[model samples]
Target: MTPRSVPHPRGVRLVEGGADVAVYTESAEAVEFCRFDSDGNEHRTRLDQRTGHTFHGFVPDVEVGTRYGLRVHGPWDPANGLRFNPNKLLLDPYATAVEGGYDWGQPVFGHDMNNPDQLDESDSAGSVPRCVVTDRHSFDWGDDRPPRTPLAETIVYETHVKGFTQRFPGIDESLRGTYAGLAQPAAIEYLTDLGVTAVELLPVHQFVQDSHLGEKGLRNYWGYNSIGFLAPHNEYAAGGDGGQQVDEFKALVKALHAAGLEVILDVVYNHTAEGNHMGPTLALKGIDNASYYRLVPDDRAHYFDTTGTGNSLNVGHPAALTLIMDSLRYWVTEMHVDGFRFDLATTLTRQGGDADVHSAFLDLVAQDPTLAPIKMIAEPWDTAGYQVGGFPAEWSEWNGKFRDDVRDFWRSADSVLGTVSQRILGSPDVYEPTRRSPLCSVNFITAHDGFTLADLTSYDQKHNEANGEDNNDGESDNRSSNNGAEGPTDDPEINDRRNRQRRNFLATLLLSAGVPMILGGDEMGRTQGGNNNAYCQDDEISWFDWDAADQGLQEFTRMLIRLRRREPALRPEWYRRGPRDRSTPDRVQILRSDAKGFDPPDWNNPTARTITFVFHHDDADSFALLLNAAENGVEFTVPKAPGQEWRLELSSDDAQRVEGKVTTLILEGRSFTLLRSVTRKDVRGWARAHGYEVSSKGKVPRQVQQAFDDAHR
Candidate 1:
């Protein structure tokens, strides 16, 4: 009987009585399909089927649990970027699920370390992980649908799947640090109650732990070093026995969707785990090194590294481009993901060794039907270059400018008020020309890479001594203030100031115009002991400290998110400027401390520290935000509303609500105030309910007002 074959869908697809496997390799002289038995016995079978640059074969009685790998026999010349060694078993680039762990002790490199000119003769089959054939249709995804939360309404919570739940007391011990743990009822409830529409999970792809980090007894806690693009990390699956990782991941997605929360994956398409020329022979490097990686024109042996990862993926090549798109589509269609956040996304847009706005990769992604609609976010810059505010209109960018300016403003850096104002208004200075909405800026104060929110307030210097690089591995210039004391302090005043600063950061992020992304564990005041870069610390250093969480801060963060959701003036869909319309009070006006009007001198004043953001909404109710960044308390005259009176809604200083017309309000230095304006009827009712003698038009008697003010003070 003739062997059946297909070339369109490239992975190992299970059929009625057999499996159809297809792989692409442009430079392979011969491609051999290898199978592993229960006892790890190798069975070699030559692929007789062939299409243009793709090898397809149909094997009979290929069971679902079959473990397999591919061997590409090609040139051994590394100088010309043709590194193909059949001795080292290569993982299937399109493997949906991978089995076993890679051992770094074994010779996994194509070229011998002792002799770089000679090929490595050692067989790496035992050390290398094999791809497991899985039944894609096995998981019963009953009524699982992406939340499809509007971008304008999205509140992203960036978290690591393992680090998020590794020490979670609410989850079962057996399921901790796994996908199941993240989908636990307790976890879902926490996220849902926090009012975040989506959870942007750190990479869950099957990645290779760095050999050097392993030697140092530290692992890659952050899953950025990926080897298998299409496979879920089996180590993250609670039920690891048999090929249940795929299903476990699917179930996690299903559970998140069921709870009305979207899952956005932080995908690393910029580079692979395979390091430079001396790197191990994994999947892409071993199969087709030159085609998959961006090689140096002068020296093909070396790679053009843009991600600070040894080798960058050549998105300029069609094969590599298709693989990225295929993997993304697989996650969306098969695994049921809502969106993606591209790591080192600027590297993917490089064409001719320069980042381009209209690069081939971006154009392809914009044109692709499967990917255009989903939420796409870009880290927007690579290690080589900074491309903030440089992404296209279709995508949202992680606003590095917003992060820096917010940190600087809170740290009392001079000349930052203007920049912070621009950032809070969704960075119209950056995205206005593109005609993108405020959602184009993904505003975040702290992210996974830098210091956690708690640490940002506690440490001014990075203490990465445990990472074994003499405190040189992480970033310097942390843009943080220790508030008169380094690390934890016993002084009550210092601690209070630190806590207030943290609240200020959270309020600023959540109350900003663009989409807000809270770093996981920040709400609970999780700290990394000043280790800003804890990428290699897989132990307690990186895990979420559930035992020592600040419950007050958590509740405060929840309240902030709730307020952001409740107030439309906080999360405006469009960029707020002069006014939307005169008929309805749809205007965003910036006023001086006197609340008169915007003056050039007042805005240009270098010593100025207070401004009022009056958000005149279409509804009768409006919001007046007063931000005071001075060291001394400032008196801000409330901006006159057309027909409504200002009522104290919320204050970062923990001030009590004092309703009625707020002619002049006192805002503490380095504090924020949120006031809501109410109508005549509501003000009168509030005044009456508070035991104040109110006139017919809601104006309280002079003595009654004085009593209320004294009581609040």
Candidate 2:
């Protein structure tokens, strides 16, 4: 009630007297903060004080869990992007928690349907969600600390919060498909077992299930169409309403941190659920349309749509930038999330009609103390242009080139050998000029927008008809292969080949030099039945199947990740510049099947399918990787050390582990193998050193077991 009190931050801030509510709107003629009682009756209060662009007011005796929204009275001129209609209630842009879902049938449009030039007088109080007054300082973190896994050592696991646990048998039925489900013992155990340091959840922010999807009896399973940036999606919380999501989300973060796992949210700050000028007025559009969205320069009635989402948020505006920054900080300081993956991130860096690395948004992130240390990832491209390695040194980008090259190599596409080499070697051609290390490139073969690992090797084309788009919605060029037959087959050979290819892709992803992000259920061979784009298939098509999981593939993937962690050579801190000498630390050597150093002529040979990589680390065990993608088996000349022998560690062909002296290795077609060098004395004197514990059965001793545990730990 006092005008002299300092204005609270955006959104609801509980004060000693009542609550201080503040909202930012530069062009609104009048801002009315409306609160609704449990019976749905509304009490309106006009904000009496204004400082700069922020409007603030204190409501006396107002308790927590109060449902509120805003009604802005301003000029409703769509042609100039001044769409403000008091008849439609708007959710607070800074709302920490939302209380309801959107109804398409409700009169939520700011402009009249029949006469586009006139403003609609219909009230949207029943259709829009209410922002709740929250006390974010109440949660007890109790010594919870982020894992802060170094980027070089971070292995990301991309998963959907609800789809990840919706059918997980080990989780309680009541908690399944909720935030609590992700923190369940089984879920943590699974992530830890998979050896991933971080989990990049597909959009947990409050998102909209598009009305078109609703009409087709489908839902936005990916949750990319976000409307609320500061709030966690209320649907993911197990119980309670309003601000309860704040506590539930914090609890999830605590649990993940307790298990040494980081959480990264896939954020959609590039666009909102509110589409183009024809779309409904939700929050930003109804409050300050011109300031929030980027309208066409010559024609304000249309939007400067770069995200293909009909409208793009006008980050060019300081208020818009502040909104994004505030939301990010709230998630970090208040909700305790580890990082964010900006979807269509290039759009955010566009200033003056060009993607500038020194753009205001990136500069804000670089200068901010709270955001600089946290993990920042960028999808790195928008619908307008691709800026694959254009992000600054402070951030890591999803290496789209890595995905395509890895897929091409496994699919046996021609002219892929050269591309694959550069990709798996941390993509020096892309990130070297900036002096960035391997961690700058987040390597992933499959992501949420495309096919699952199983489907990638099982179907050559996308079967997205289930998405109700007549198979025209998803990408056409999948860069995938079916090997022999499409879909599920009864032939043992075809099925076996598919499984081998899957393992090959997974091995390539984990063993490559960079941060590898594994698609969550890919370890268990989770499939979308060939639906490469399952954005709208919220049913069984998108939900992870727990009962029929491929345990073998899961275990194989676990082994691969463990191998990656154990061998320091696999994950180098710096970009490899070739071996200075044989004894140099972190030496990288590329070779052909003939044991010859990577010859320039051979690099361009289309028939050159077999390549070997020898990685040497002074502080850890060394490894040699052999890749064969030809039609016939190839005999590779094994490199020999002066006083050491090579030991077969793992093979994609199910080859038996060989321990005796070997001069040459023969790999099967399209298979790979890993070899480790051991001192000749250790191999010959193993029985004597172990005192008969090491039998002729070729099993490693307890020393190796301890080493393995230490590597994984």
Candidate 3:
């Protein structure tokens, strides 16, 4: 007999005269609700467990400031990812605010791991932080229009949340390093002043610390690990009064939008911070691990280990996909976020059937009219599956080739000029015919994973000692070259060269034919103390130093961004294919410093040091850029054309080295030149810098002088 009725516990689904907010619990052998009061007073409510539980009745009069938590019960299985102990007290996965910090006690880790399932029966009672209830709603957001900045026009600044403002003097002490800090007039002004069109935040979702990092007295600095999809990291929001993180974050977004900037989140849907099969049994694992994660292909005993953190999310499952899609929609529709940069996106497209490039996950996102209109970016690669330009249309991917080629040209380009040409034109060979637009490629030199522009010119190899991994971590071959020294010095010659190289790289980025992304602090010269993977340090080493600037760098950065916004050609869309479309050549023209016009460059050309490329925009518009990366100057000549005079607007050889904005005469030598257009008998500045040389019949000399005169225009 079913024992007439097993004494059912008392419960409440709708708090008497309360609001619509409700919480649910999956298992309920033991569950209860506790409300905290300001005067240290507390209220208790019993929830029925015998009948099982999924939701807690909504309580009223509970506005913005509400604190509550749950008590649960279950076996504390460790190896199996099941850590349910009612005594320890757990935070709600949907929690917006949390009380207390990681106590670092044994309770923090689900299982003793060492104790083994054969040993400890300890409940780890009285430990673990509790979740706080948050009553979030709409904001006034007047005229809070998203920048709606075109992907092609965006220059992203990837940065850590806390590190960005904690030391910023302009932000209030309490607000510094908080979502509120990012919204302060000062923070908003800094972004606009610096000219970054979008701020690609690392991650905002609540996440767990890497067990290794936790034991080592460190924490995950980069927020790549995620726990709850809808919940924001409480640590990232300031003035944590009654779980106000949601409001604070929304406020920050509104402020950024008001400043004419967009917010692009670096989202990690690839995996959860919950590690692999041997990891802790958090919400998902506790609910249904087999369903939420891709169990190692055909091996049911293991999880797909593509995320490096140990497990890959199974987007193939509807519930899992719902979680991700819901989170994305909430951020876009509810929070009004501008876009997302999917980390290790290739992993998301892998299907058990075919792993089609046009997978279901992508198909859904692309078809969603509302979501499709937003800026969609993809990291596009990962360790398990690296797909460079393989993502479908309606998305822009980080062009690793752009990073590599640009790095080579300036660092090792002296020896590999051919590779440089392929990159400057948007890596069309790799991304074209996919029918993807040119803007689909996000070109960058230094990102958060590699050395900053400053370090690229300062350190030839990664100095990852600060990462506590002894120099074994990070990329071994960065294709980087320090003009002379290793890190820093007072050697004026080397420093000058390094600074010039930085200028060259930045200029090239703005001039390229793809969406450009500028790593944060690359402008003010931020360093990770040579720690390329400083994802564990939350100190000054990762922060953008507010004091390091010499005026020259700042002006140069600002002017470049403004000019980038000026030219339509620089921000060209995908090359639409048609009869009118320019049939791109396999290898086009590369004008040598001494050459007159376009011709194929010889890799065996032992004497060649500088090569200027003239990108022909299908008989419509063409701009020629000269790069004399050699230590000394090269006497470049303007090739014979319609004698069109090439007017030089920007040059690195300017006496002031003023960048960003300029209106000056054409300069020469030891300089990189950007010329607009030219006319008949108009030479693109050739001989004057090297001084005049004797010519045959005096025509050649005069011709060179004519080039110089054109250059001076």
Choose the strongest candidate by lDDT. 1
After superposition, candidate 1 runs with Cα above 4 Å error? 577-586, 655-659, 679-713
Model 2, span 1-713: residue lDDT tens: 37353455776677777677777788888888898998989999887778887788876656788888899888877888888899998988888889989888648888777776788888999887888877778789999998899987899999998999999888999999999999899999989988999999999889888998999898988998989999899899997657888898899999999999999999999999999877888899988888888989999988998899999988899878999999999898988889999999999998557888999999999999989779999999999999988999889999999999888887777777888988888888898877777788999999988889989888888899888888998897558878789899999988878888888898899889888999988998898999988998877998999887999998898888888886777888776643233344436678888778876787788777888888776545567888988867899887664334566777788863555577678888788888876533344354455454444445556575444434433
Distance from true location, Cα of 274 in model 3, Å: 1.8
Tens-digit lDDT string for candidate 3 (368-466): 877977888888887666677888877889988888877776654455566665567677777776766668888898888878788888887788886
Candidate 2 ranges with C-alpha deviation above 4 Å? 1-8, 577-586, 656-659, 679-713
The reply for model 3, stretches above 4 Å from the true place, is 1-65, 68-91, 115-126, 297-301, 353-355, 413-415, 575-609, 615-622, 639-644, 654-671, 678-713
lDDT-superior candidate, 1 or 3:
1
RMSD of each: 3.6, 3.8, 7.9
Look at candidate 2 and give me any clashing residue pairs.
Answer: none
Q: Give the TM-scores of the predictions, in the order they appear.
A: 0.94, 0.94, 0.82
Q: Point out the higher-scoring one by TM-score: 2 or 3.
A: 2
Instruction: Report the lDDT tens digits of candidate 1 across residue range 270-345.
Output: 9999888878888898888999999999999899999888899999999999999899989988998989999999
Which lDDT values do the candidates have, in the order given? 0.85, 0.84, 0.67
